[model samples]
Target chain A: MTADALPPRTVRSAPDRLLAVLAAFDHAHPALCLTDISRRAGLTLTTTHRLVGALTEWGALERDADGLYHVGLRLWEIAALAPRGLALRQVALPYLEDLYEATHENVQLAVRDGGEVVYVEWLSGRSAVGVHIRVGARWPLHATGVGLALLAHSGQPFQEAYCAGPLTAFTPYTIADPARLRRELAEVRRSGVAVSSRQITEDTLSVAAPVHGRDGGVTAAVSIVVPHATAQAAVLVPAVRLAARGISRALGWRPEAR
Target chain B: MTADALPPRTVRSAPDRLLAVLAAFDHAHPALCLTDISRRAGLTLTTTHRLVGALTEWGALERDADGLYHVGLRLWEIAALAPRGLALRQVALPYLEDLYEATHENVQLAVRDGGEVVYVEWLSGRSAVGVHIRVGARWPLHATGVGLALLAHSGQPFQEAYCAGPLTAFTPYTIADPARLRRELAEVRRSGVAVSSRQITEDTLSVAAPVHGRDGGVTAAVSIVVPHATAQAAVLVPAVRLAARGISRALGWRPEAR
Candidate 1:
């Protein structure tokens, strides 16, 4: 197909088309050429060139020496102002670090978004586990500790919708039954803890607890992952709860007697 | 003021209009309504409404309860992959925390951008002096300890260009004079440290050193801020230097020394 041969076309709005260009880049595809972006965003070359120029001029995208584009520093600066992203991470980091120091295990802070737990902060430790969760990664509510903790406290309607998922199991031991997942969430609410064993990975176990915001609403969840074979779920449960409560208090969550 | 009475708008390209809408938000005005966005982006209400709706649908923007819009979690998730943003901070944080513990002072990480130093991370210690610096805050190159450290190592052309700046002075102690600032940067290059005293604020002092990347280029700077009245700059210098070096080593910078 020749570039000048095609008739002008339009369907999606201009803003949607421009944003689609940005959405094309991900962790694996962090950098892209002009052609790569056009193909990935499913836009014509002319459209992509115009959109890329605008984004580059506004500092939304940066083009490097190899003619590849990256997420620019200006975007990062603005994103730093996001209340639920960097702001929350900043407030929760010290407590997360303390947990890491105490356990020398993989520490994570995550928030639920549309039935999935999006990891915001990950502190890699010397202790190696096979879970392999990274910042910006997501997992379904029934397959991870933070996921279960967040899902358990997400109110009745949200829980009901999430439990209807045809869950993908990473290992044979993952909780796949809708009825059993319902019972497990109830247990999480009553016990104030979620212990996920061999769900995401065969050799890793995670303990998580809910964190609350100033308005006494469950805002986030914190967890620690350890080797499943030698894990002491009982011993780690108290420490995980203590860390979550400390973070919740810092966020101005005042708990009454349960 | 009816919509039909308005004249047909002058046509900007599709990408320009869309990008202008996103560029409307900044640190000073993080949230806005539809009218505000239209006014700020210089677009018609029709165009603004369409673009805002598209962006909201794509998750680049989020509307709050009262209809004010904010930078959304999705954009922040993408920005988290910026190499100079969260990615760099993630690697430097543990060492910065150790420095904060040892000094009990305000610890910071910054990188040079367009003749200014933009802070990427800030750890406000409990006992630190009250110097108001927020993450993503930018300041003149000669006015901050981290700035001087970065400026000193930023190659000869950049250093010379920055030295010709019309420096903004926050306090009487600020190094606003071009000649004196050049001399200070030179000394920073020689001593491998930068001491900024009572510059940004009369009650605060900062000690800093440069961090190098794997390729031996100055990539970031780390610093500690203390009370100026009772400060020991000499004592803090070594600690700051050690922290910077530790972070550099972690980033795979190998300083060849016998």
Candidate 2:
């Protein structure tokens, strides 16, 4: 499967073709012309046109007045009912807000999606430490505090396999060694807290804890991003853990009550 | 469309079938078994199985340990990026909160979908107003304050056509008459506010104002609900307008600058 022997455009099934049109859109390219979509999705002009038209008609996609396409409101409406997405954020936001108010930091709520952490909610006050992540932004499983907490509870085999991955480093403090990453994950599980210090950026640190669902399994994670220079990392750990526990209780997770 | 004959089920295309499978889980039926999906989507068991499998694999639907299917995190992640949905809500929430803090009432944000007003965001406060609408719930365009505010600004032809509808009445205050509803819409447009007094319930009043997008077009509406007995509807009008203007300005809508 060398680059020289690759097919011009691989044939895709109907469902795959339809999904490819959606995949053509991301945070980088939220709006795309038909030509851009066809080029990015690696489909012919005719196929792209038909698929886009079908999606637009079904309200899965929207065509603006300028002839640009974006995801439509109907799809957003349907997606609002996703339990793991807005529903979870809906329950966790109050606690997240309390944490933000208490600490004046960047508060985040994220869930595991495949091997990445997709932020479901993020709130930052005016004077909070800056991080460029948005609600729909994704990050690797080992770089973010929320990511570390989610990855720690993701089961044993997943941890082993992910630790073997090709880790990318933005700063020297980023975990690139498999052995160190494995040890960090173990510490995260043992302490019930994940401290990702100066991982994503040199000037920032994050304290995170897991959020459990009705079944007492870690369904999501909450974290607070603070400036490394002024952060009381140990003190922030209890605050993050409390918020996570409050959210988990709100989501129907109860050990003592049961 | 008739009550005598059943609709054609098998004639639906592959795209339609896939869309139907996603649509089968709504606010009422947020989780469904494989059998429930087949029956609700009006598809055969085999077709439902295959489409659900593909959607599950693609992260559009998630099957729980109990084998029940719920809307998945991926769809929610994509929806969070929608400008008219959570993206809009996130920007408007602070203002919505300000309005709520000014008066501890039920705050809501709604957008026009077809002829109905769909509630996109809601904050339940301690004050009791009786009409309990969830985030994704829809109501008639003429029966709610936010709905009237949005419907009044939609366009001349749309307002005219909507006023000719078979309006359903929840109470005597509800605008079931076409002529009176048209008059009320005119008042809403003239005043830049909509005050619906017990339109949907016997003891509730909602004051709403229209929200504008960057292009200065009316895109959505925001409202605050309070008890009809204790509410000074006149006093709330200014606060509602101020909050709406704040949200509009935050969205880059500049009336004077334009």
Candidate 3:
């Protein structure tokens, strides 16, 4: 389904209705008029109007002069406090910057969200290879370097379930076989790095390493994406690992504790 | 009032109660237990539980293994679409990075929110001056360089009202007098830059320039904060202004259109 596709309209409770109004918005539909919201949220126009008014007053949404509703600054302020979102990105930024400076390539920090990897931070130079990833973008857990590192370090049951099947391929090189995927994950665990070549895009490659949290759990993964033809996994691995370790240390990860 | 202070409880509507539960979390109280949220939101334990359950189910809030609630990744994804928040920061980040590279100081992008300036992005080197500013941090519009730039370019009515108010001074150098504040704003407009010295902190200074949107209105401001003892406004002004202009251009601002 498309990113903007709404789930079957089963919303019933007052809170659910209100949240459905919010759920109407996505990356593809950031701004919407009252009528559009009503349709997308599967709500009556009257209910949509009332809920929209409440949200606008509470600053969860903002209505522009043109009568389109957009997500507001207040919501952004609150979201910045998310431990796995901006907070993690803020802690990892300096290391990400150092990696960017060293590689002049596209750098990313991501965490696993169930079956997908959600990018929390991304930094790229003006001249870096074109990358489709952006903050908040998501990819399946087997199609990118950060995804592989996260999957390899994830709980066994989850890793097994993920390796079961339904792997979507973005390029010919994307690992579609369950056994091969499991083997690749094992390799990632052994080497402490994941090198994904021409997986998401044929011309792009990435090297990634996992970042640990204060409790020594793999909390996130950091990666650098470079052009496939000129990519040097050997050189990129150590830098990416160092950046990830720096972020892990900043997050209070102690290697000695393990 | 402190950042964590709650307003007198008058919230009655269903939407208001739900939003109140969200407002309970802030920079100072990012993680809260159910009891804490109940008190902060001025809701009964029963109501707080119901609202928290709804919010958690909707992914607006996440309850950790320890049962502490935090703003969730899904909410962050939705807030990423805020035109004045992450969206604006995304467009301006490359320019901010360039400014950081050139100055090796604390670089910031902020937008005016009522009488305050909300920092949307901040970048600093490991060795950059110790700055208290962080992403999502807010300050009075007359105190810091980005704030001053934003306030100077704000609408006349808003500017006049803000200038007439009780300006809280952080340091002796902060612009507290209405007349002097007005004069400083005038100079910011006349010089196309704002220089705020030892306003927020005694050891820091900043130079800032207003960033224009497509409509030729100042939508945000960019600034670089450095140690006050070595700050040279003459040297920093051009770089800050150029970064602001670069961001403005990226936002589709056209100088010829004006």
Candidate 4:
């Protein structure tokens, strides 16, 4: 949905209005001017100016020489402390690197946020399949390997609710039927790996495995994406699972716990 | 300073109070209960609870299963748009990885924030020097090689204000004297590299070079730390400078632009 469709801010609270300004920035609109922020946030020009001034003063946003506003370094510092974000990526990077070296493919670490999988980290290989993925990018839980891995391990209630959904499809192979999605998730849990082929795109296949946190719950997923034409699921599955287990161990997960 | 040292929140604005709650989380304290957050933010329990609730609903703060609050994934997604944060690191990572493969040392990418250098990326080598560096960690601008490189190129006014300061010394080898620091900065600017030995610790030395942005300004620095006893400046300097230049070019910096 476009930002212009957001509801007006007259009835929102002070904190809500303030957050609306920040929420106006997203992957598609990373930089904005005051009027753009006002229209996107559904705030008046005066309110946007005041809130933007406050945010700039507090280092939550920065204005460039060209007068365009971007997210600031201070906000990044705070966000770096998110356990599911940079902190998790920092712990999982070495293993991800090893996985990349082993397969020379695109490696990703992602966590489930609501019904979608947010990619927290991605390491690109020079000759890997051309996938449209970046750090902080999100995709539906039924369409990608990492997403399937996470959704399968997400608890029964959430899984049931997710299956009863308007499953969006990016390609012809995407699982649009809830019954098929449910079966795929069950297979993922049974095999301890998820292989998604040509779901998001026609030329790529991904192998993913769930990563456990200290509490022994699946907190994240690790995956490797390669060209589907020459894909070797047998080799890629084991490598991806090993990387996930290595990351889980690093996160204080013990095999005996489960 | 401890959280108790912050002044009361009565005089602050609404945005300031909300931001204080976010600012309460840092490297040392990434998670907190409501009471801890209230104390750190210097707000009353009621105000803190209200603000925290609003933030949690907005997905800027998340409450864990154990009831501790953490900076959330949604916040990280927004913060990823910071030009000097993950955006810069994204463009620089391949070059940084090449440098790590070449040196097999502690590689770092840092940007100057005020008078300190904030490390945005770090790649650790298994047997490399055990330096106290982490992503999002900060160090003064006069005691490390990356800091020196950034400080040298920060223009004369900022350099003068930074040098005429109470330089905190971590080791005896640190440049605490203003005149010596000026000379060191001049050398960094002249040679296009900065070499710092035993400044942060007794066993580690670093070589760094400045990275320029599309606007032709030095916006960041890249460095590699190694064991001081076996350090080879002639070899490391060229490698570090090449990595920095490569990252600069990726950021749209051209040699002919200047």
| Every model's TM-score | 0.90, 0.90, 0.97, 0.96
lDDT of 1 by residue, A1-258 (tens): 344222334776777777788887888888889988887777899988988988888778888768999888888888777667777887887788678767877889999888789888887643446457777778888999999999999889878887988878889999998999999999999999999999988998999999999888899999999999899999999999999998998899878733
Model 2, which residues run further than 4 Å from truth?
A1-10, A101-104, A125-127, B1-8, B100-104, B125-131
- lDDT string for model 2 (A6-39, tens) is 2336756667676677777777778889988887
lDDT of 3 by residue, B1-258 (tens): 345546546648888888888889999899999988988988888988999999999899999989899999988999998999999998998898889878788999999999999999999778899999899999999999999999999999999999997999999999999999999999999999999999999999999999999989999999999999988889998999999999999999999877
Candidate 1, which segments miss by more than 4 Å at Cα?
A: A1-10, A125-131, A256-258, B1-11, B125-129
DockQ of the candidate models in sequence: 0.50, 0.51, 0.82, 0.78
Residue-wise C-alpha lDDT for candidate 4, range A1-258, written one tens digit per residue: 363656564688888988999999998999999989988998888989999999999999999989999999999999999999999998998888778767778999999999999999998855677899899999999999999999999989999999998999899999989999999999999999999999999999999999998889999999999999999899888899999999999999998956
**Candidate 2 lDDT by residue in tens digits, B1-258:** 333222448687677778888888888889999988887887888988888888888888999888999998877777666667777887887787667667767889999988999888886643336566878789998999999999999988988888998899999889999999999988999999999988899899999999999899999999999889999989999999999999999899999978
**Which order, best to worst by DockQ?**
3, 4, 2, 1
Worst 10 residues of 3 chain A by lDDT: A1-10
lDDT of 1 by residue, B168-188 (tens): 999999999989999998899
- Give each model's clash number: 0, 0, 0, 0
Better of 1 and 3 by TM-score: 3
The TM-scores that each candidate's chain B achieves against the reference are 0.92, 0.93, 0.95, 0.96
